[model samples]
Target: MATLEIRDLHVSIDTDQGAKEILRGVDLTINEGEIHAIMGPNGSGKSTLAYTIAGHPRYTVDSGSITLDGEDVLAMSVDERAKAGLFLAMQYPVEIPGVTVSNFLRTAKTALDGEAPPLRAWVKDLKSSMEALRMDRGFAERNVNEGFSGGEKKRHEIVQLELLKPKFAVLDETDSGLDVDALKIVSEGVNRVKESTGLGVLLITHYTRILRYIKPDFVHVFVEGRIAEQGGAELADRLENEGYDRFVTSTPVA
Candidate 1:
């Protein structure tokens, strides 16, 4: 069991005007077996929060700390953080033309566990997970996300999550660009993985459609690089009804 803590996190991007801060003193905490949904408008720094937690190189941590299970994550490299039980499913999953999904998963699993699984068992688990996601067995042989549909790409990320079994995972817009059926499949996959792994989830999304399927323990409204409001699942419904204009107008974008 692990807890992910982000305290007073301030992120900045390099620009002509020097470092311009994006995340302003953001504070969030997620413990094992909890799902935290962060919703916000465009350019509100929701993605920045996700990337910072994942230790993306472009996002400069002006001030703050990201701690997972008592270790300072900001000091670790991206690969180190992944080894330390943190996973980030990017909003735009890249396409690696030469890398097969099977090979990629094998490398990641071996790196995390310090040993590779038996060939038979690894193939069985991968096949079963792909079947659960409604994906074809051929997907394992295909290059990662190369020529895949939007839904397929998103499902691929879920496949990675199910296989990796990281202690803490940040899903950035996993629900975006997915249709109704794809959304349900992905949501179900997420739920299944969480149920089995007891992983803490920080889900970054712009709409409530996904929330209808996976009930979040907490829903937070992020505006102007900070969390403006947070509450139970009902808060998601409230935002759906009222929209985000009031909250967006209140917070200056900077």
Candidate 2:
């Protein structure tokens, strides 16, 4: 099975004042076919972890390593990460003004796979996944995330998740700004992809609402740039009841 490993990972970014450390030393291991939820309050470095794993140049890795099945992930380029079966669904999906949804998805698939998919089969899969997410057929012709409602943008991300068929996916704040119905629909789309592809997920969020729909195999509490607590699905229930006060007050690891 594929494994994504992070050991003693320290990350920082250059701000106006100076370089600010974000991830102190985070160690995590995710295997195929598991959903690991990383939950914490805002600015706890949850989103930083997601972007760092995706190799965004903004976050500098001060030390440690991120490996995919013993391969040096940090050595690979951003596109190489995706080609190696890693996908990141951003908190704020960006708009590609001139690129239509169908073209973007197809181009991405072609880039990842080294060749275009059979056109007929690609169209069929695209239509099916979009329908499962309850996206209108008209969306296929619309520009990528251009003027889409927040919920629609999120659903579109999941559509890419299903079509890309990555071995691992980092979803940052996917549940934010979604209403009751939209939340459930997005959650269903994620669950469907997991069931079909055994996709390992690192789902980052602040609340337990998304957990209700997409059950996590493991729940991790991020505080001060490190995992403060971890447990099974029950941990999420406790967090929903108790919040992060206990974890927040603890001393951070150096």
Which candidate's lDDT is highest?
Answer: 2
Cα lDDT tens digits, model 2, 110-165, are 99999999999999999999999999989999999999999999999999999999
Error (Å) of candidate 2 at residue 78 is 0.4
Candidate 1 local lDDT, 14-120, one digit each (tens): 98978888998999999999999999888899998899888888899989899998899999998899999999999999999999999999999999999998899
CA lDDT, every model vs. true structure: 0.92, 0.94
**List of clashing residue pairs for candidate 1:** none
**Which residue pairs overlap in candidate 2's backbone?**
none
* Residue 183 displacement in candidate 2 (angstroms): 1.0
